[model samples]
Target: MEKIHYRGFWRSLNQAWRGLHYVWKTEGHMQFHAFAGVLVLAGAWWFRLARWEWLLLFYAIGSVFLSEVLNTAVELVVDLVQPNFHPLAGMAKDVAAGAVLVTVIQAVIIGIGLFWLPMWRWIGG
Candidate 1:
């Protein structure tokens, strides 16, 4: 195993940002998630979501984003270790992607549940 270095806090944050930048640049899924997140946030603002609702929405969105980043990391590491196509490597990537799909589905359900009544009331008014 390679030795790990302990970087300062600011350096750590910068490195994290760099990884996010790379994902944003290379991954279309990340871009779509970002756009969807923005739309959810906008809806929250428009509806004046309750504190609990805000927290739930944040958790859902954060989980999706976290899963996406982790999935990307898993894919990168798998590719690095196994440059050629392998069944196990493909399986690993598929599992990671499945995690992102699960989170996205959860987020969508949460969004619909929280927004449904408010949206209907707004429109009905």
Candidate 2:
């Protein structure tokens, strides 16, 4: 195999942005996650989360986003390789989806833990 010349850092960054744009445009789940992530960050600001709380919240958000992007990539690859209905391809897609679901659930748990008490107190008070 021939060695490929390295592109500049800016070109690599541009490619990454293109991938993110593709996901945002093509994946409804990604759109939903982006909206929800914005809301969560806004809530963290509104609630004035502590340093550690902010760290945890950001970590959870990043985890879910990363999972979603990877899942989308997996689905796209599976579709490309096996456009026809095949059991193994279906299983691969399902597993990728499941990974997204698990990450979303964990993020929800983290959000609830971070916000519930503060919200309750704010509402009650």
Candidate 3:
């Protein structure tokens, strides 16, 4: 594993921001994700979930973004290589989309679980 140092934290932040910029630039889906993140973060704040719950939220957000980036890459490569539709190309695109679907579903479940307690308390459940 790569050793992490506080001294390089700013550099790490820059790298992550650049990745976010690329995603926002290339993928329309990322806009929706940014909106969703804001909404979920609001809930997370209200819920006051444990540190581990916040960790889970972060994990879900990162996982979805990673899957989205990969999906974008796959579509770009496949389109460049095979402009004409082919069976395997279709399959590749389908598989990439499937991955995004799976990731989004998982993230939704985690978000709901993370906010459930706060929601219940507010609802007097």
Candidate 4:
């Protein structure tokens, strides 16, 4: 295996941006997650969430984003290495997708917990 040379800080940042751009360009699910996250942010603003609530919301959103990015990385690496249909490769992709699903589910639950009371109060007034 060849050792990778360490690039400067700016170069590392550029590479990270490139990875994000590629994923955002190619993955519909990532776009959907981003859209949902935006909505969550808007909801938090409308509700005027407490500082702790805002922190939790941000954590939840970040978790989803991280999981989705990791899933994409796994899928890309698996495809590159395998390049052909194999049961194990399929399983790898499926598990990665499952991870994203779990993240989304938890995020949704956190959103509900944080918003339910505020939403009801706003609606009642």
Candidate 5:
């Protein structure tokens, strides 16, 4: 195998952006996560979340996005390797999706803990 030369930072950044664009374009779940993330940010801003709360929220959001991207990558690789209907390939895809579900569940728990009270107060008071 030929060794590839190390690209500069900008090229690397562009490649990363391209991967994100590919996921955003091809994956419906990613679009949903992006929309939900936007709503979370809007609510966080509206509530003027504390610094620690912001940190936790950011961590949760990042974890969910990271899990989604990794899940997409896994599914793509599985499909590429096993184009036909293979039980193992299907299991691999399901596991990848399960990872995303787990991440979303955790993030939802965190979001509720962080925002539930503030949202209730903001609406009721």
Candidate 6:
């Protein structure tokens, strides 16, 4: 195989493009999420949420995308190695999915904590 030159830069760009495509298309939940994330940021900016709140939002988005990419990698590796149905391979995929789920849940909790009360007050609820 020919060696890739400027591989670090190329690799970063490739990964970024893949992630953009993945978030934009492949992940069903991710589309809604990206939208919601945008809305949250807009609200935060409008409301002038604290720096820590913005930090938490950044972490939330990072966690979801990172977990998703890791999960995709796990699934791909499992398929490449097994190439057929196998209990262990299934377990590997399940575990990866679980990791994404865990991140999503944590992000949701943090999001609620960060946004919900302020939203409630804004609505006078």
> Best candidate, lDDT-wise?
1
Could you estimate the TM-score for every candidate? 0.90, 0.89, 0.81, 0.91, 0.88, 0.80
In candidate 3, which residue ranges exceed 4 Å CA deviation?
Answer: 1-20
- Please write out the lDDT profile of model 2 over residues 1-125, one tens digit for every residue: 97765677678989999998998899998888889999999999999999999999889988988998999899999999999999999999999999999999999999999999999999995
Tens digit of lDDT per residue, candidate 6, span 1-125? Answer: 97867979899999889877865676776677677779878988988899999999999988887888788878878999999999999999999999989998998899889988788989999
In candidate 4, position 47 carries an lDDT of 89
Pairs of residues at least 3 apart in sequence or in different chains that clash in candidate 5:
none
Per-residue CA lDDT of model 1 for 19-108, tens digit only, reads: 999999998999999899999999999999999999999999999999999999999999999999999999999999999999999999
Q: Regarding lDDT, does 5 or 6 come out ahead?
A: 5
Report lDDT (Cα) of residue 120, candidate 1.
94
Give one digit per residue, the lDDT tens place, for model 3 in 1-125: 98879769988999888876887898999788878878887788877778999899989988888899889889889999999989999999999989999999999999888787789889999
Q: Clashing residue pairs in candidate 6, if any? A: none
Where model 5 places Cα greater than 4 Å from the true spot, the runs are: 1-6
Residue 88, candidate 1: Cα error in Å is 0.7
Off by over 4 Å in 4: 1-7
Candidate 4 TM-score, true structure as reference = 0.91
Displacement of the residue 109 alpha carbon in candidate 3, Å: 1.2
Between 4 and 6, whose TM-score is larger? Answer: 4
The per-prediction tally of clashing pairs is 0, 0, 0, 0, 0, 0
RMSD of every prediction:
4.3, 3.5, 4.7, 4.2, 3.8, 4.3
Model 2 Cα displacement at 90 (Å)?
A: 0.7
Regarding TM-score, does 2 or 4 come out ahead?
Answer: 4
